[model samples]
Target: MQMEPIAIYLFVSALFILVILKIKTTNSSSKLPPGLWKLPIIGNLHQLAAGGPLIHKVLRDIAKKHGPLVHLQLGHVSTILVSSPEIAKQVMKTHDIVFASRSQPLSAKIISYDSANIGFAPYGDYWRQMRKICVLDLLSTKRVQSFRSLREEEFSGLATLLASHAGSPVNLTQMLHATMLGFTSRAAFGKKYQNQEKFISILCELLKVGTGFNIADFYPSIKWLQDITGLRTKLEKLHLEVDSLLDEIIDDHIADDNNNTSMHEDLVDVLLRVQNDRNYEITRNNIKAVILDMFAAGTDTSATTIDWTMAEMLKNPSALKKAQEEVRRVFSEKGYVDESNFDELKYLRAVIKETLRLHPPAPLLLPRLSRERCVIDGYEIPQKTQVLVNAWTIGRDSRYWEDAECFIAERFLDSSIDFNGNNFEYIPFGAGRRMCPGMSFGLANVELPLALFLYHFDWKLPNGMKHEDLDMSEVYFGVTVRRELNMHVIPIVSKPV
Candidate 1:
């Protein structure tokens, strides 16, 4: 007897469901860590939906009940949320070799050429090579020093833009966004991007799509939603626009032909030269991937932190006043700030560090995938299980800090606790080999410009707006968390000391 089409479809669906359920049951029973209830198709979906800003709060609570290593089934995948610091250290340090692989996301694959870039690439020789390129050639201290002129130029532009809108309410978040993007473009391509504003707008939109929850990510069969809804088309168009911009920059270099081969080269030129040499598996797609990672992760996160730092300072007037006074005192007579002056600006560095403690760009570091079974906190984490460390919550853990929630730049003023991922207690850039390679470069991009802004101008809210009225609500746009309301302040030229 032949079955009807609809009946056959239902039968197949039911069979798949049974198979999945059976697998989940087996996994659940297999001496794995405990977790919240598993709903047949959605498993732990309700928990994620309910857990908001303090997703870690929920995870911590769950871990308390289930033990330190709690396994969660979000959609079709199994994820392990590690809340304890010991477990986090082990995953990031002890077994770094085995757990260094990044979970390959569909969006990251296309943009990063199947994780060829350092930020999301799996642990291997490819990642090692990318790190070498980023460090020795691109993001090294010497390389960053070479880009000082570019930074100074961008800071000048920032000052000019802020001055034009002085004495009136200005959206500083917007200014910082533009400034950080300008810095990245100059460093990466050796020239300021022509369409700076539009470029960032498009890239942010792409980041939203990349990090936003998608049905396709969990249920690939419904991938048609992304395409049918034109979301895919939108991303493709933006990708092409970015491609055109980079291509034009590449063309200019080619046209110049003799564009000073001896001088310090920008990231694009280096990557292109590497591709031409065919020394390794590097390709055009690989270059684009690295560039995209720099923009998506490096630019946005640095800018977001600067914006948050400013907002926090404005909220706490004393901190703002103190930071500005330090800057003015350090460079009272200097016409403009430079990287050399950065060493003397200690308080400004503190402000940036304190801001990161409260709002890490990625509250939860990118999920790590285990290559083999392991035991964490006396609980079993099976192979391929996704692991996420709550850096946001970790930063605020009172067990490790005094007045954890308070933004006191003084805490870092005399301390050696840096964000280069060494001190797990303050890991804005993450820890171990997977740590962010652009930390030094990214930090410099934030500091000098921010110090200059404060030194030159006195910031305040709009007329008739009280400090209490300044909105401090936060919003997460992919990896970077920003103020829900753009920070608007009036920048008044300070009386020269």
Candidate 2:
């Protein structure tokens, strides 16, 4: 009476097919917002063609047609794209408590340790505690300032690297990316992986998979396709890469535990000490998750910002000249810029602000999922719905800014408004409780290096390329959005001191 394995497999497959069919048949009604015609199960799959540029732009167009709060079915799931600032405020402010949770994919969950980290964790006590620890212990103003020497050391190296190839057009994007990777990796883990390129490549792959439009994310029934097509394999490779690096780092800490007596600290040291003491319900896995969050969220966002900032500056020479003038005038004859000089670099701050407005690293911010039914700007948003606020469109909204599309740093020179997520008009880092806990650390990472770059090097487009013709087209991979092309700038050493 023993059953054959083939028969059992067939029976399970049949059951799964029936379950999928039943679910598709049951939820076939058009309860969501108005969208293009859809087929059964696939919904808008054909419409969401490759690259997603048309979809990204069309979503805004649809919102304008349907309303500020527009809903579309990706597969079995419901997606709501919010464009108007009014609706964004409702979701992020009025219904903050209900919609603060993250709707991450399974791969994201595994890499992020079941959403235990702040960037991907669900809205609850665990997130609150982890975010608190990150802010107070690791990302505080004092902690960020303490890392000034690291920043200065890295900046000097970057300047020297650029100076070595002064006559040639250097790819600032790639160079800046390496600088940021080194800075964040060392500050977090006390050392950069020897294979910096491999480590970063894995990170890039993870971000790609996490943010890359997958047919399965919108449609639950087709999720098995992700496994069948080796998407899962890629994620596995990335996870193994990240995990191995972290494990090696942890081993190093244990080996050096008895004799290491450095007063100057890094994040790994703090987390290791906390883990050894068995304090605060945090285990080794949780520590790994937080460190992963720090690297993933911290490194890419900062690097993307620097890249975008430089791109924007290159496109607008007037702004670039103004910023350079301010930097050079302030730090004339100084070997290089440092944290102490940041306070006086007013125009540099404005330039970075303008860069953020036009190109927010996290254009949609992180997607927030609702735990309960809520109303955003009089539109009813049901429970378990995904909420997306287009900070990209919001930043370009003409109502809050004059010539919003232009890259003008002077707009902020006399204004008190900032991008700390407080002002609904400009929420680059987001606001409220879920605001990026690492804001200070991120800002310091951006400002000091930016000032030094402008002060030391006069930039120009490569091979007589006109600034007006430079490509501003973007390709969004994940939460981090980047320009479609790597920006190259010729650094003319301006009258050496």
lDDT by residue for model 2 (428-471), tens: 88877788888888888899778878888888788899989999
Model 2 gets an lDDT of 0.78
TM-score of 2: 0.88
Judged by lDDT against the true structure, how good is candidate 1? 0.77
The local lDDT score (0 to 100) that residue 292 gets in candidate 1 is: 83
Candidate 2 error regions (>4 Å): 1-37, 192-198, 221-223, 258-263, 276-279, 333-335, 495-497
Q: Which residue pairs of candidate 1 clash?
A: none
Q: Quick one: best lDDT, which candidate?
A: 2
